[model samples]
Target: MFEKRELAREHLKFENNLFAQRLVPWPLLNAPFEGSWCVIAPGTASTPHAHHEYEIFIAMKGKARLETGGKSIDFNVGDIVHFTPGTDHSIVNDGTEPFEMYSVWWDAPMAENFLKKHVATEN
Candidate 1:
């Protein structure tokens, strides 16, 4: 058996060039498994931020220069990267193509607490 959940594309909110869509938003999942798809237009970059989640990225198309915790790594399609908690990270698309990736994250204690509150409200 399989769990089939279909969300229409129109429900996703993609605003601008450095767009991030919570492809499977935590709010929608109402669980700790959070994931998203980011599309960075050529010559744009993502804002550096840190969080409690262990972040993992899988490059699906184009290329990008990733800066994380004072180091830089250039990644192309099929590359993957993982950033630990509190690692300041950002992605830059220097080439003339859209850089897209799928990212997912989950926190242990923090995620547990957040989900507790989230599920409580939904109940």
Candidate 2:
């Protein structure tokens, strides 16, 4: 039923961070139906970035402040946020302890474009 896949952690690229490492994706969870968890160190911040996928995040531990398309939201533990393709977004750990969150993202069109743009030269 599935056409392509990438193991989260195996193929993870550094999303972004100023003070700590975050988002260790499991390659298997890179698909639209899959998901991953990222741990953010306190006082850390992620720079603005955009993806060609639909994404969602749920704060699992401490507070997480997120910005998207010039809008900001302070998410408490258990709060979930959704984002669409082409939207500029960023994340930050704004609580005392380390922050953990679940991320679910997928984009079929982007994957096709990526393959056409990069994999054509993989051989």
Candidate 3:
């Protein structure tokens, strides 16, 4: 079976106070699909953004809310949400504990550029 540990680790610049650790890739699978395990720390939110790719989210643990188009939908463990491409969305942890979820992307570019201009950061 295909496993995530076998896949290379790549970090994505998703949003402010948030980032994603990509675990699985489409190239590893027999078919075209990408899988990832995202860990959202407490007091943080996956920034509002959109991509030109079909996306789906499966809540694995903790409490969180999915925000899209200025509306919020509370999702818990075992909840699944499927939306089309370019649908502006983000996730926030409204609870005390960290939120974990499994995300997948299909038939689209793996990495997306959220920042247009260079912002000098103090390292």
Candidate 4:
């Protein structure tokens, strides 16, 4: 089965004062990974948080600073960032316009098992 949805503002949900929309593994689609589109208003920051899943962020628009591992890394459109499991991180939108990004995450154990199975088959 295939599930498709338009990434529009009407689909966004307000969470923690940020606008976000869950895409993959959504109600109509079941997958191993979870994905979301997030937008942070200018001069705002997402809450610092950590989880047990590995995550990657793809900057889509505007500019922001990623605060993680006690370091602040600036990122802009076309930039990609990865976070290891349990790494506390947050995005701060310091630019004049809203910051947009896509986030994809999966459990560490699930990824490890997938690699084991796929790598062995390839070998």
Best candidate according to TM-score: 4
List model 1 lDDT by residue over 1-123, tens digit each.
245555444454564446766745344445565777788889988878888789899999999999887888998899999888898988889999989888888888757867788878879
Q: Model-by-model lDDT, in order?
A: 0.79, 0.68, 0.71, 0.86
lDDT of 2 at 14: 52
**Alpha-carbon RMSD to native, per candidate:** 4.3, 7.0, 10.8, 4.5
For model 4 the local lDDT of residue 84 reads: 90
Q: What is the Cα-based TM-score of model 3? A: 0.70
Q: Clashing residue pairs in candidate 4, if any?
A: none
- Residues 1-123 of candidate 2: C-alpha lDDT, one tens digit per residue: 244433444444455663322332333223224456676778876778987778898887788789887877897798988888888888877767877777777678646655665555556
In model 2, which regions exceed 4 Å deviation? 1-15, 18-31, 109-123
TM-score of 4: 0.81
Candidates sorted by TM-score, best first: 4, 1, 3, 2
Better of 1 and 3 by TM-score: 1
lDDT of 4: 0.86
| True-vs-predicted CA distance for residue 103, candidate 3, Å | 0.5
**lDDT accuracy of residue 107 in candidate 3:** 54
Compute each candidate's TM-score over C-alphas.
0.73, 0.63, 0.70, 0.81
